[model samples]
Target chain A: MDIDNISELIPQPVPLRDIDDSPGPCCMSFGFDLNPLIQSIEKVGLINPPLLKRDNQGSITIIIGYRRIKALKSLKADGAGCRILSGDDILPVECLLLNLYDNLAVRKLNDVEKGMVLARLIPWIKTLEIVEHYMPFLGLPSNRATLSSYLKIEEEMEVRVRESIACGQLSLRNAIMLLDIDSISRSSIIDLISNLKLTVNQQRQLIEYTVDLSHIQGRPIPDFLDDQSIKEINSDTRMNNPQKGRALIRYLRMKRYPSVSKAERKFKKMISRLNLGKTVKIDHSPSFESPYYRLEVLFKDGQSLREKLENFMREDIDSLRDPWKKKK
Target chain B: MDEGVQKYKSTKSILLQLKDIPVRAEKDDGPEEVACVSNELKRDMGKDTMHLVSYQGEFLKPCPGTKEYICCGYQILNVGTNCPLDCSYCILQTYFNRPNLRVHVNLEEQLGQVFQTIDSDPDKIFRVGTGEFTDSLALDPIIRWSETILRGFSERKNTVLELKTKTANTAGLLGSKYRDRIIVSWSLNSPFISCREEHGAVSLTRRLECARECQSEGFTIGFHFDPIIQHSNWMDEYRKTVDLMDKYIEPEGIIWMSLGSFRFMPALKPIIRRRHPETSILDGEFVLGLDGKMRYFKPIRMELYAFLNELLHQWHPDLGLYLCMESNEVWQESMGWRPETSEGLGNYLDERVRNFFG
Candidate 1:
């Protein structure tokens, strides 16, 4: 804990191969590109030496600067200067805290990296302690639900999905929905989402509709996604990606709610048959949940409004009954 | 000793009797534990557990009704919170933060306060019920709530106590001599829904048989066709229930029957999905209503109500049919008339009370 030393601890030139470079228990870096660090080291020869901890077996582990070592190795550098500490001198938790603080001071961690930090802390600290002290330090809301979500993400999600989330391709909310299903179905849905390049709203609808359909139809989500109509929408050449995404959602929604869709179609047909002028319009509430229909006339003045109302009164408005109702 | 146990003389006997019943040590696959989101709360909702607490709130409170719809103006006698039954569509899944079968052991001591409130308004008819927060008779065998509070309400002229339940455990009520102003109501649903959705509930036949037994004993009865769902051949399914009612129950003895469609707050949707994964109750087309709960579309609701109205009216036109938490438009369209407001609906039900008990 003595930081104001006259001269720092001795820095030694350690062979890169001697150190275990894989993300150790202390590492919180994930879904990162090493090329930028490699290019930086290539230009400015490693200014701050990485931290290493040597065990009793004389094996070295990188306590900090995991990305630096990975970058150095990628650049074919055989050795780098690193400060060493005996593993007995510092506890594993202290080492983790050192790495965490070191990373926090420089750059913000991605969602996956934050999960990694919380996961690493779980073994050494109580949940409440973590929620109170460390969660705020990691810039997360101090709640058990959020903590459970992060733990599940780190412990359950595959590398590809985590990578997608870390790189800003998929949202954390949508990824949580994927966790409720099996891995095969999750992968298929993830692939479709990526290929279609769905927006956040579209991604949510896609997952919700797919899950509801699977439960209703008593089939796996992958099987439902493999339907011929869905594939046709995906492979349609004339439609763009956004159009296909919309068409896919429309197809699934129609399948999920057949009665509502039929009623909507009938209502639209009936309204078109009325053919009131372009200035006058009739609109039903969302899903036709309300009993009353709205009438709007875009008139320029009182005389124009009166004329439109007279025209509306002349139409057979009583035909505008509940679409599902039969004619008397 | 807690005040709840010290004040109520029967709490000691109830606790002694509860010790004889074997409770599951671990949580079961029940709806109460499944609906819990937090681990702390889940642990609190122990399997088949009971808690004796002196309820601190008012013993009698008005039913919390929204102004967006017609309300029956029923008074809720807070006998307890939570229930022994685990019906899939229960709103109590998320209604309370605390969990367990909480029996207000001080209910007997607080009856005078409740009566005072009712007696203060001499002209107002208190259509009181105990089944709003919990089932009326599900735990009656052990708790003996009927023995404590039945006579008090039965002796009152301006008040009627209705014990609504899905269980056929009416032994305590039948053993009692208080039947003048007491209405034993059964929540009736279609047989398909009864078997599939109403977990731990008595069968439709058994319930109807109980009603017949109660009516034969000179007790006026009521029925609620609430949450009338739309399913495959729903008309036929409900008609089957009606036919069974025709067999076991007399139409003349029934006082009032309520018809309501399936509606719930949005928060209960996920809880229902999590608890009842294989349930088909969520397959209907629902839209947000004016009161912020998800309900079936207007036309669908009209279809359900109109169909049941015709069937019930055919059974007995004087069965005093009414709709729960519905709009004036729905009442007019479905039942051929409208109560127009909550007060109007309350007056109608109060009239029913007077006609039955006066």
Candidate 2:
């Protein structure tokens, strides 16, 4: 991993007009604002030279530091200092590598950008070297699977998704799950994640639920999600985002399994029928996952216990009767 | 087919002490099935590998129940930790941190303490079972657990030792004459779930046939549709199993039949996905239950139980049918009654015991 090959490209002042800002053959930068670059340059003067390439037309293109060049241009500087590659020496792969290496100092590459760059470098570089050296250097796991996923980030994902990745709002895993779904559902998921500020576990649950429900119902996730009832929760004005989220989850769960939802409604109704106040606690097992149910009644002494017992015994004990056991 | 004890490991010599059995020392580094790095090593897991490790924990623990449910007061006899038969929805896959088919050779010694504890409380019906952490009989061919435990409960007037299993490996039970208080139970699922989800277990017909054999031999048997999975035409599939049960089993000998829908810890979902990629068990709708396990929603659960309860009741009016780990409302809606508390459930089961054994 000798970096000395990049030293031959000497820094020289190139006229801002000579550098073509036209979209180059290998521009990976998207929507990167140069305000920080502009601010830094304005304070400390230009320190690091931008990596530029001179084409056969005798005009140099800003390969790596498009933001830096733009920042200099916005400051109305006539000339920009750049490490220039000239005359039949610069390969496109090297330009991609230099672009990747240049970002090593600027800012951390998000998974999407890292994926984009790794996608480019993997074609020519030996897979093992990239996995062992480049991947770890780029804060990625040194594995072919991870490298393959990052490679997919450039082509499978859209510009907005890439922006989501860059802003650290979307995870690569969610992005990958999103890719399996349609754009409409993907937007909905991304919206949920970004809006709800979904934790990692919640995001995973949401994605798995959405995908599995889609598979079961044979409907697109968003189509099922945008049902008439769920639409009300989504559009409800009285509820805050969290409340809406909770309500929508319950609605989605009900829609996903109609029988289970109905049972939940019935169980709640039964609980209300008990007429047990806050002191007289009654709760059923979670989804009947176990063989038993518990009834907890709070009492301080024998008097209270007897009272609670009386209340429980008096509350329509028909459901608790064993049909086979003879009455005394 | 006859089985052989080809390999063994133990922190004590209780397993090695068995005479006339050809027990060979395990030559592998140790049981590293969960952390094996190589693809071949991972594939080599569940490869007829058996370990007889010394168990350091309590041999008898209460069944893990949710505070909100009517958990049957079933006690677990910790004969082992992992099962030889790998069911797709088995909570043991997530319940255990270390992995392998490990038989606690110390179980024979611990049974003395367990029985002493049970004998001390003669009025309390300790409905103890050994299949909670492992199938009570799956490893019987290798470990011969029924031989060690049968006589201990042969005349225990207060307790009933249930040898619950899905395996047809019941030779150990058949050879013994101790039948005073032993219930050999089989966990039955629909044929679809049995064929698809329960790997390495004997088929439903064979399992019921084995139950028939045990029942004919003067052993009171039990049937458990403990993990009733919701599959396509599940009612038809389950009714097919019940039909076979009616054909093969005598209803009078069945002590109890428990119905439970498939429930699992959330952690098992990923493990199942990774370990069993071809499985369709996780394709159903699930929600996180109060106990942090993923369960089918209430309506779906009740629907399953209700259908089965009616069909089971139709088959036999007094099969001592009960729901395993269910709510009072579910019991009322599905089975027309509820235990309402762990003690009530225990009393109900004890009454079943008095009816069957008294």
Candidate 3:
């Protein structure tokens, strides 16, 4: 079981077409644009040959470096110098495991790709063993819950969601929630979140708001996400991605908690109804996660402070409490 | 009575292995069940198998409540860990990983211990319920938990046993003579929610019909409007359910009616989404509450509770109305008064117990 025994000192030049593109079910592909990879290969030649195994029909399926082959193919290279298996001898699990080792030592794998790897290994190895032994090398939390969660995403997720996952746009936590929704809803949700390119935390919040909104409305989530308002933000050509992201999330937040949003809106309208001078300021929590509030007034001197205090006192603070806090 | 309880499709058989089982010793299906009992058995077959092992944990624990919210100081009798009747918003979906109806086979054997704890605290009214983690009667035909629990709580003056169920599995209770302190409660929702979200559960009318039959047989009845999901025309649907309750149930015969807005752990949102793709229960307006669980926004919770409170009060002013896991401000606004503390809520319920069963 020497690890070094699996790999050899030299590689063979195998024809590009002969290296069968279909890498079977277990191959985890990054699907990156290969121009950059081709540039690197052209500049430095092949770092290491693509890993491969010879099948019964003398056809070769890639064991690793699918992208490397693609890069080489784009260059019209006739043959890839491959670290070919000695014979048609390696198990599929061994090939995947070796590839997993290659990814770990060379290019770091994202959670989604790790999920793909885990999905393949899950059918062959015991889950407890995978949870204990394999997850650590992939940098995943080594527990049955985490392992099961990743496999669920790989096996059951919609193709659109899987695409985001493949592109490293969605976190495993956010992707897991998407699975609970209908297929059409799942992709639309992933698409919205992906378009916004929200951070992992914001992505989670956005997902929470969307899922809850979907449940509360009893409408398919895609219907809510596809609202004319959100669609405008999604297709808004003027705003940047950040603006669109904020706008989409803001729309979802308002829809998700209509009462809180209404209360805050009324509170702001009443503050404006106060007819306070522009110098005075009113602020509320960005969202209703906290009920904490802030009030600010610009003052130049004691006389100005006194005048601002008088104006604030004259304003009906009780008006704010009267109805929003009051149960209808 | 079995007709009220939705019969489980016998797709899977009970995998039982208990040291105390000699009654059905001929089958010899015990060893394989023991092997499966260890949760290391993964989802190899894509189907869950029910394991009725004699659980080896404390069966009774205080209901996990957040301090930010006013708790009702209820005790949960852990008779089992999962349910068969699939509600879309059920937390049990993600709460346990190794899935199945894992009934603690020894709950019947452990009843005396739970009752002993309750009996030990005579001054303290422990409102004990077995339906927190699992439906108290969903498996009554196979588990027969009602007879054992009713037999134990028959004369326990300090404690009231609440067997909360969505099913009409009262054949066990019907056969048993002990009914003094047993509360056969049903979890109700708006007609829309009942039909749409609470899958595999008997209809609200059927549940009310079951309540009526149980009340007629001298058992005190309870009703829980737990997980009241918000939707369009929710008021009318809920009112229809209330009207049905008035039709089938005698208000005076009921000892308690609990109203709780829908709440769930944030982790459960995805689980529900995946488990029930067609579910709209998650579409409700929710906020990450003082507890990490997602709850309806305060005003929304207040509105739903206040509406149900008014409707239920109109049906009967003395339904012993209470809110479950809400802040004090919510209590005052929704129910129009605050229990103030868990002990205060406990005392309020204890007063109801004294009035009903003293």
Candidate 4:
């Protein structure tokens, strides 16, 4: 965009203009703020005169300076004069392009956003396309494979990430990595993340362990739920230790489709069988709140609850039908 | 004397040529007065912080492959190596060849390397950090290097940039439009170190105060306790640090908090002895690990972990705390948990960062 004489440009203000909310084909993101522009206007007194277009019905439309316009409105509301420079100068296509360029250039756009922007830009001009266009415009190479990878959505992994966010368990970085990982390792990864609520380093260790598992197993990483090995281990391995039992129970609970609704029911049944609690109390959150379900069992002060649980859950024990078992 | 050499009189300015020249005092010994300045003078000098020299070089490079099995899988950004501050136990003394700090002012060159690597593999989420080789934001205000780096990576989804430092110098990143794209992190330690070994560094309160400000500005903040020092009343000291963190900083705003016992290379001991003779960092009970770095024994490390873990859980159960360069067995003994692999840490951390800020 070429700049003309600063004196020749005339500024015009549209009073109480009725503009369409769903205006078609505008390059501005809805949440753009005008404070920076207001500061700019305060300093230089509106350097790039606001651009305006007129419709056949004589309605004035703002082609650029959305931020400038909003700042004026706020100024008017505060009982200050909405002092704007009226302009009659016609803005060239390059000028409109400059507005978009300035906005996109300074603000760093993420890979996905860049891809979406580039994909949208493809239709604007057909002849000058691909990486050459982006290279000149945004300093990004428009390689198709690179573009595709940014746009790729591993839905299962995304869901797990969302679940982590929901449960307050995982982070966005870890979630994204888990999504990109081989599907075979996703289950064990998900189990580790959700169960122990490991830190970033621990989670990384887990992924490294899974990668090693893949290398050693001679098979692709297994889906934690669908993997035959994990299932077999779950079924046959006795929860001999309390910690191990708790982990297994957690695995089972997570596996229960749509989540095990009556988590308290299992606790109640176990309590009755083992004479576990003197009194049992349960707390549930308000629908919108957290800890959707919680079960707390109060045992007698002198009771050896830790030992009792450990004895019942030993991996060597064969059957839970009989709590008493000894080696031959 | 040449004008360039005359202009660079102080050890501070001389150190700026670290990457290029071996820094030596004019008196043949060292800059005794520069070394003797009270911590207060250092802070004053920070305001009119001198930019001695700038270099044109690649910023982010892939980690050099090590023959040793255990390596921190981190990519280095040669932004600014070594710090101007006189921290007695600073790893920069041994990490770099000379004490003079260097800031790669050739941002375009740095960006060229970074964008090249990131563009090459869009599918792979690379964990690249500037703090690995330099204080990521130490020269932030004067150079605005981190701002430039942040701007460069802001558009890429596959890369997460971590600007780790002990300085609260964040004027360069006050109002980042791409706040989600970068993580502003701090290296945390007990208040004792804030007064002792960490000379010229901001106080713990000031550091957390800055973190609080960053969190308010919608930046994902991180805390690192790499080299969690062993000392008398270590648990109490660490717990106090965590409690203070909980008080000043919001847990959700934190992306990750790493725990690492203080480990040192055998070669670094002499450097500390010669340079910072008064430092007590090498005084603690430590043994050589498989990696051959002197470390606190397994039991001491475990005790520190267990106490810190409980305190962190009590403070914020959701806070992401992971150990740095620790074994799976250590993890199990301390936290009663074993991560299956290295990716477990990366994946969990990635998930936590994304989920927390996605």
Cα lDDT, model 2, residue B1: 8
Candidate 3 or 1, higher DockQ: 1
Reference-based lDDT, each prediction: 0.86, 0.76, 0.76, 0.57
Worst 10 residues of 4 chain A by lDDT: A318-327
Over 4 Å off, model 3:
A1-13, A24-27, A47-52, A64-68, A80-83, A152-163, A180-231, A234-238, A272-315, A322-328, B1-50
Cα miss at B228, model 3 (Å)? Answer: 2.5
Model 4, docking class? incorrect
Candidate 1 chain A lowest-lDDT run of ten: A1-10
Rank order (by DockQ, best first) = 1, 3, 2, 4
Candidate 2 - chain A - TM: 0.73
Q: Tens digits of per-residue lDDT for model 4 on B1-358?
A: 1123333223233355344644332322222233233334433333233333334345667655333222335567776666766677666666432234554445444476678888998776766788875677776654566445677666777777888888989877885577756888999888776677887778888899999999898888889987788765767787778888977999977878888878778666555655654556665545556666767655567777777778787888877888777777577767677665666666777677567545
TM-score of chain A of each: 0.91, 0.73, 0.78, 0.37
Error of 1 at A51 (Å): 3.5
Q: Each prediction's DockQ? A: 0.38, 0.16, 0.31, 0.01
Clashing residue pairs in candidate 3 (N, C-alpha, C atoms within 3 angstroms): A180-B273, A180-B274, A214-B283, A215-B282, A215-B283, A215-B284, A216-B282, A216-B283, A216-B284
- Please name the candidate that would achieve the greatest TM-score relative to the true structure: 1
CA error at residue B86 for candidate 1, angstroms: 1.9
**Cα deviation of B344, candidate 2, in Å:** 0.9
Tens-place lDDT digits, model 2, residues A60-81: 8877777778888899999977
True-vs-predicted CA distance for residue B31, candidate 1, Å: 18
